[model samples]
Target: MSLSIVDNGRELFVVKLIERGEKIDEHVQREIMNHRSLKHPNIVRFNELRNLERGVDILVATPGRLVDMIERARVSLRMIKYLALDEADRMLDMGFEPQIRRFVEQMEMPPPGARQTMLFSATFPTEIQRLASDFMSNYIFLAVGRVGSSTDLIVQKVEFVQDMDKRNYLMDLLHTQCDNGAHGKCALTLVFVETKRGADALERWLSMNGFPATAIHGDKVQMVS
Candidate 1:
C-alpha cells in the first residue's frame, strides 16, 4: 500500500506491503473505488483507474476522467489549490516519471498566489529529487530519521530453533494462546512463511491443530509480489 501526506513545508509518502499476496490491480481498484465517492472543496478528486500494460498491472490515472464528470468538474484543478504527488520516488523508480511529468505540464496553471505543490516519498533518490525540483518551487529538505532505528515500531521477536521444529512449536504456542482466550473472540492473527510449499504445509498443520490461520506470501501468484 502507498499513502501520501502534505504539510506546511513538507510532504510525506510511503509504499509498503499490506498482504504480500495482494495483486497490484486489486489494490489500485480498491483505491479508486474509495476515492470516487468523496465530495469536498479542498480535496483533489481521483479521476480514473487505468491498468498498465497487461503484464504490468499497476494503475496509472489521468485528470481527464474527472473533467468528464459534469457535476464533479468543479473538483478539478480549477477549484483546488494544491497538487500533491504521492509516492514520488516509486513513481520515478518504476518508470512513471515521464507520464507524471506530462501530467504536471498539462495541468492548469494557478494564479500568482493561488496554488501550492507538494511531493512526498519514503525514500527520495537522486532522480526523484531532480524530478521534484523540476515540479516544485523553493522547498525544504527535511527527513525524519531512518524508519526502524528511531522509533522501533516493528518489534522482532526471535526464537532459535530448527526449521523442522517450527511448525510444532508454532502450534503449541498458538494453542496455549488460544486457551488463554487470544483466539476465542473475533480477532485476527497473521502468519507469514517463506515459500509457497512451506506456507501450504504450515497452513495445513495449523488447521489440523485447530487454529484458524492463513498464510499469504509471494509464491501464491505472479502478482503476489
Candidate 2:
C-alpha cells in the first residue's frame, strides 16, 4: 500500500510514504518486513531492523543489503552506473542523513570526474536545500514553479474539523467514500495522518469499524516524518 499503483501495475512508484502525525502501525510494519524479504537487483533491501532507545533504525541498502551481502558474497556493485534517492526530502526529514552520508563516503574513495547526484522532492526548504548543496557537486536549482504547487488535473478538497473529532471525521469520510458505488469500483484511498501514533490509532479504529485501511509513519523507521 505504500507503493502507488498505476496503469494496472505497469508502473510502480514506491515513493517515500510519510505519516506526519502518528506513531507506527501494522501497515508500516508489514511493508518493512516485506521489503526485507524481497531480493532483486533494482530493489532496496533492509537487513538489520534496529529499534534503539532514541528511534528505529533500518539498515537499508540499495541493490542489496550491503554489509551482510558483501560478507556473504551474494552480489557485487561493480557494475552500478548511477546513484539515486527517491523521496530524498522525506529521507532527510526522517533522519537517514547520517546513514546516507556514511554510504556515500564509502563509495570507493571517489572516481575521476563527478559522480552525478540527483535529488527530487515535493517540498524544499531553505535549510534542506543548503544541506543538499553541501552533499552534491555543481548542482543547479531546477525547480519549474512554486515550492508546493498542485496539479490542475487533480481535484482538491479541504475540510475543517476540531482536533478532537478529526479521527472520527476521517473515518466517516472514508466509509462514505468507499460505500456502495460512491468511489466507483474499488479505487484505492490514500489517507494522510499527522503522526505515527495517530496513524496507528486511526488504522486500528478503521479496521475495528470494518473498514479496510492501513497507515505508514516515521516511528516505524529510524527516522521521523
Candidate 3:
C-alpha cells in the first residue's frame, strides 16, 4: 500500500509509527530492506538523523524515537500528509498511548480532516476504536473474515514427539518436504524455540545436517541488507 502511494508520483510526506519492544530492531531492519528494494530516490533511507535532516518523504519510526527527534527539532509533523499506525493494538498494549497521543495530538500535525490517518491491526478492541474516534474523521472501518474466528487460509496440525527424538523427527519432516519439491525460498521454515541457546543449537544442527537455516532472536543484532 505504501509502495503504491509512493509510485503515485506525488510529493507527499508520510509517517508510519510502529510498535517498540524486543523486536523493534528487527522490524526496523525489515522496513529498511523493503525501502531499499524499491530503489526510489524519493524514498528516504533511514540513517538516523542524517537522512532526516535533508527532509523525508516517508518516515518509519517508533513513537519514542520520533518524539525524541521532534523534541530535538530534527523533524516536524506540521507538513505530514499521511499518518499510519501499524499494530495499533500492540502499541497500546505496550503502553505507548502517551507517546502516540503526544505526537498525534500535541504536535504540529494537521487535524484529522486535513491529513489522512490510518490504523491497522489484526484485532481491534474498544480502546482502539476510541483512539480512531479521537484521531480520525469520517473514517471507514474495514474488517476481513470474522471478528474472532480464524481464517480458512491456514491449516493447523499437531504432533507429539519425544524430546530425545525431536531433532530426528524434524529432519524427517524436512526431508519429506524436500522430496515433495519444496526448495529454495518456497522451502523457508520458521521454528520457534523456548530460548536463544536452543535456537542457536537448532540452527547449528540444521547446518551440520545439510539443511540451510538461520535463527533469529531478540539477542541477535539484525543487519539490514
Candidate 4:
C-alpha cells in the first residue's frame, strides 16, 4: 500500500471490461508458456513492465503511464539500448512530447547515437517530427503501403449509417462477427466516438443492445480512493 499505482508499475495496465480482465491475463499466460523465448512480442504489451525491470529486449507502454512509472519509481534508463515510439504521431496528438522529451533528454538513458531509435506512425507530418527531434540522430524514415493507411494487423471498416440506423448497424456488425467466429472468447472490441459524453452514451446503448461494453475516458475518470 506504500506505493501509488504509478510506483507499483510492476504490471501492465491492461484495459478490459472489468468482467474480462482476469480471463485475458490467463489467456496471455497460457500463450507465453507455449513459447520457449523468455522475451517474445505477444507479452510485450502485458509482461513488459516486469521484463523491463529484468532487462528484456523490448518494452511497451502508453506515454503518460510510462512517464509516471519512470518518474515516480526513479527507474534509471542508462541501460536502455533501444528507444522505439510505436505510434509517434499519436503520442504527439495526445500531448506527450514534454514527457517523452524528459525520457529522451533528461533521463539517464543513452543519447540517440548510442542507442537504436525508431519512430513509427501511419502518418508523420513534419511538424510532429520536429517535436521528436531531441531524441533522434541520423534516422531513416520508413513509410509502407498507402499514406494514412490503417494498420495491416487489423481490418478497419468505415460506415455511413444514418443516425437512426447506427444501433442496428453496429448490432449487425457484431452479429456478423459472431456468426463468422471472428472474435474469440477474449477478443476485445473498441468503439470510438468524438466526445466523452458520446462514449458514455454509446456504451450504455451497446449494453442495452445486448453487448457488454465499458466506458472509459477523461471525462469519466473516477477518484481511485
Candidate 5:
C-alpha cells in the first residue's frame, strides 16, 4: 500500500492505493455475510460535544466513520485509549483495506503497547492474521468451537432431477402438501431459481397452474457512507 498526501487547511484527505485480490474467494464472501448478520446495531452514531463532555469511554463504528470522527475532533489523539475491530478479516476486503490502514497511519493512535488493540472475527485467514500483527503486541489468539465447519454444520438435502421434471415435481409436492392439510393453504415455500429469466418463467408457470407465486430479486442497498 502506498499513500498519496493531499493537504489543505480545513480538511485533509489521504488517498491510499491497496491491491485487490485477484480472484473472488468464497471464504471472503462468507465472512462478509457473517459479519453483516449483526443487524441490531446497524448504524452507530455519537454526539461530538455531548460524548466528550460526559467522558464517553466506548464507541463503535465502521473504519471510515471512525476516521472521519477522529479527523474532525477538536481534542488530541491521546484521548483514544482503546481500539477494537469487530471483524478484522472482512474489513480487509477490497476498497476497505486502504481506509483502515490510512486510519492506523494518520490517526495518532497510541503505540501498540500504550493503547490496547483487539481483533475479532469468525474466520481469520492466515494472511489476515499476519496483516493484523502490525497493529498488535503480545496479543492472545483464541480459537473456539470447530473451524472450517460452517457448511457441514448445516443439514441440506441435495437432489438432481431432470430439467423437464422440475415443474411436475414441484406441482406434485404442492398438491401432496395441500391434500395432507400440512400447511393450511399455503406453505410459504421459498423457491430459488438460478437465473432471472428462469425465475420469471417459474413464477408464471406456478401462477398459470392455479398457484399464487411471486419471484423476488435483490437490489443494491444504498448506504450513506
Candidate 6:
C-alpha cells in the first residue's frame, strides 16, 4: 500500500500515527533502515517538526507530537493525501482519541472522500466502529485472518524455569535446537528481558557461549545503516 502511494509520483503527503514509547524507537529505527535502503527520492525522512518545512513524503508520528506540531504551525494537514492509523485500537485505548479527533476532524485536512484514510487494528469494538463511521466514507471492511489467533506456522511453548536456572535452561534449549537443525544458520532468536542491564547480561552470556547476540535497549545508541 505504501509502495503504491510512493510509486504514483505525485506530490504525496502521508501521516502515520502510532503509539509512543521506548519500544517504538526500535520499530522506528528498523523502519528508518528500510526506508534508507529504498533510496527513493520521493521518500523524505522526517524526525522533528523543524524538518517538516523542507517537505516530507511520509510522516510517521505519534498523535501527541503531531498535534503539537499542527498547533505550532509546523505541520499543515491540508495537503495530506493519505492518513493511516496503525494500531488504531491501541491508540484509542491509550487515551489518544481526543488528539486523533482534533487532527482529523478540526484540522484543515480534506474530508473523508477527498483524502484516503486507512485504519488498521487487530480488533475493533463498538468505539472503533463508531470512529470508522465518523471518519470514513464507504470504507470497505476486510478481514485477512482470524483475530486473536496465531498462525499455524507459529508453535507456542511454555517452560517454567526458576530465575537461577534460566540461563542454563536457555543454553540447553538452544543447543537442542541447534542439534535438531530447527534453526538453520543465520536464523535469529529474539529473547526479551525485563531491563536494559538484564538484556546486556544475557547478550554477553549468549556470546560467551558461542552464540552471536546483540542487545538493543533505550540506553544503547542505535545506528541504522
How many pairs of residues in model 2 come into backbone collision?
Answer: 14
Model 2 spans with C-alpha error above 4 angstroms: 1-79, 107-114, 148-225
TM-score of 1: 0.41
Encode model 5's per-residue lDDT on 1-225: one tens digit a residue.
Answer: 111111211111112221122111122333334343332211113344554434332333455655666777732355555555655666766456766776765677667787666666677788567756887887788888765456566668887889999889989988877777755676667888898788888999999998899777532233456
Off by over 4 Å in 3: 6-47, 151-190, 194-197, 203-225
lDDT-superior candidate, 1 or 6: 6
In model 6, how large is the Cα lDDT of residue 159?
Answer: 89
Q: Model 2, range 1-225, lDDT digits (tens) per residue?
A: 253211211111213332311122333344545454332212223332222112222222332234334345443333333344556677677766665554455533232133444566767877568756766776777786777777778888798899989877877776566665554553577877767788898888878887777777644555448
Ten-residue stretch with the least lDDT total in model 2 = 5-14
Cα lDDT, model 5, residue 29: 34
> Which candidate number would show the highest lDDT if scored against the true structure?
3
Model 5 misplacement above 4 A? 1-55, 74-76, 151-225
The local lDDT score (0 to 100) that residue 77 gets in candidate 1 is 38
What is candidate 3's lDDT per residue for 1-225, written digit by digit as tens? 433343322222223343233244344344545654345443333445676687755666777777888898987888777777878887888888898999899989789988778888778788999999999997899998776578788888999999999999999888877777735322667889889999999999999999988889866776779
Residue 4 miss distance in model 2 (angstroms):
20
Off by over 4 Å in 1: 1-76, 111-113, 147-225
TM-score of each: 0.41, 0.40, 0.60, 0.48, 0.47, 0.61
Clashes per candidate, residues 3 or more apart or on different chains: 0, 14, 0, 0, 0, 0
lDDT of 2: 0.49
After superposition on all C-alphas, the RMSD of every candidate to the true structure, in Å, is 11.1, 11.9, 7.3, 11.7, 13.1, 6.4
Q: lDDT of all the models against the reference?
A: 0.49, 0.49, 0.72, 0.59, 0.56, 0.71
